[model samples]
Target: MAEVKLFGFWGSPFSSRVQMALKLKGVSYEYIEEDLPNKSPSLLKYNPIHKKIPVLLHKEKPIAESLVILEYIDETWEGYSIMPEDPYERAMVRFWVKFLDEKFLGAAWKACWGEGKEQEKAMEDAQEVLTTLENELKGKKFFGGDNIGLVDIAANFIAFWVGVIQDVVGINLIEEDTFPTLFKWSEEFLSCEVVKGCLPPKDKLSAFLLARKEAITEAAKSIVYK
Candidate 1:
């Protein structure tokens, strides 16, 4: 039997992505929940530079970054494919995953967490990112076409976490009518059994996000007063 261990946080989409991929591949892993503020010693040892969660330890070798872990899971495991077979298709998947992690997620976070003029600018940027994704998702059930793949896994943040954070902040960036295709994609993605099983509870996630929002607001007020 293979020894597989995963260090992750329940509320993080990045962590959930790794979980979803491992589950999709039918790979059983020991899950260790990490406290983000005070990360575990093993997590620090494994992912020293990033010091982030969703680090996969297979046979004692560590792999950091959710996207990188997903690719590793696909290549190492002998079950369902998480990435496409064709080279061009794989390239496209990599492109969209990069876009989601590096571009879209940042804008979405700022839109939910920023204030005043910064919030306004972030909302516009997030909307533009959504529009691009909406167009890409047009006529496709999933970014992987028929099934979940690398891009779909990478997009877990947009499909779920962002929505929860937006609700906590009382903002609506991913409207169904506005981004119909993307909305439909989210629905279809969440409907999958693998995804449903890996997701953190909605009520719990909402509470966590609400607390984070309050903390941000309080910090801002303190900065203003100071």
Candidate 2:
């Protein structure tokens, strides 16, 4: 058995974050694909509370949560540095990661999936976050300046999945004209060799998201009738 094992869902940006981190650090591990709806015994055993995927098992010790797993990967392995060595810069990375996960992503999700007034409000909130990120990227190639770091890893959804989902839903939030800097960053980030290797194929991802969207639409129609 491999010393390191990862339980992840293929279409999940969160799971891809851990994969990117492990690749960046040049760590060898076993990949365990999990069907989230029907989670495996190991995934349940490791993350009893959340019962979500992207769990990391290192030498029989399990770590849950993608962000937490990221830190663990950075600390446990030795090669490329995932987190900054500078104290203040590290703090900034953490702050941005929190903002992305807690504030920005929620708005982005609603903008893509929500209906009517709710989606409009979410678009406004998501745009504000995108503008902030565009300004932050003004003088840097990535959130980590030249290298891909914690914050960059954390923003996987914005960098890749957001565009795919927007296409599926026919909404344009992170376009070149609207947010040039962020759009450029997304292009660059997605072009990176490490990132390319880990991401699910675009066609497959789009199909998966489209199916989910259709289900939601049907469910909403049923609710309206009842």
Candidate 3:
């Protein structure tokens, strides 16, 4: 077997996504915990473009970016495929995954971390994204149907971190009535064995998000008032 290794931070959803895929596929690997505040030389050397965690090393060749790592793992491993075999189905899965990563995540990040009118607009945008996803999720057990796959893994943040962020920010975008499907999806997604095992402790995540919110708020104010 080739030597496999993963560099990641405990509290990051992106890192958790990779961890979930590995666990689901029964792929064993060495895990290196990276301190985000003080990044390691190895991490910096491996992911020069992003300089971020969740870098997977397969026989010493590094793959950066969580979503990319996910597809790579599914393709390389034999068990529990994370994507559809059909081309159009695979494309649709990629579509929502990309939407969550690019647009939804940014808006959700801003909603929890932005200030004043910025925060309001961010919440609206995030909700809009959620509405679209909820529509897509109609009659589906998971994002890809019966089993959790690419889209569900890509949306791991909405299932877990968004709740902590809401608590930290004192705002609620996902409620029982407001987004019933998403609310149900979150419950089901988080309860999955692989995901449950990987979620960061809620209290710790809450504390981390509070500090992150402070940094974002200060940065937003500095940009506007400066």
Every candidate's CA RMSD: 3.7, 3.7, 2.8
**On residues 119-158, what C-alpha lDDT tens digit does candidate 3 reach at each position?**
8888898899999999999898899798999899889889
lDDT of each: 0.86, 0.88, 0.88
Task: Provide the TM-score for each candidate, comma-separated.
Answer: 0.94, 0.94, 0.94
Residue 160: error of model 3 in Å? 0.5
Selected candidate, larger TM-score, 1 vs 2: 2
- Alpha-carbon lDDT of model 1: 0.86
Q: CA shift at 221, candidate 1, in angstroms?
A: 12
Error of 3 at 172 (Å): 0.7
Sliding window of 10 residues with minimal summed lDDT for model 3: 217-226
Distance from true location, Cα of 44 in model 2, Å: 0.7
Better of 1 and 3 by TM-score: 3
Tens digits of per-residue lDDT, candidate 2, 131-193, equal 899899898888888888889899999999998998999999888998888888888999999
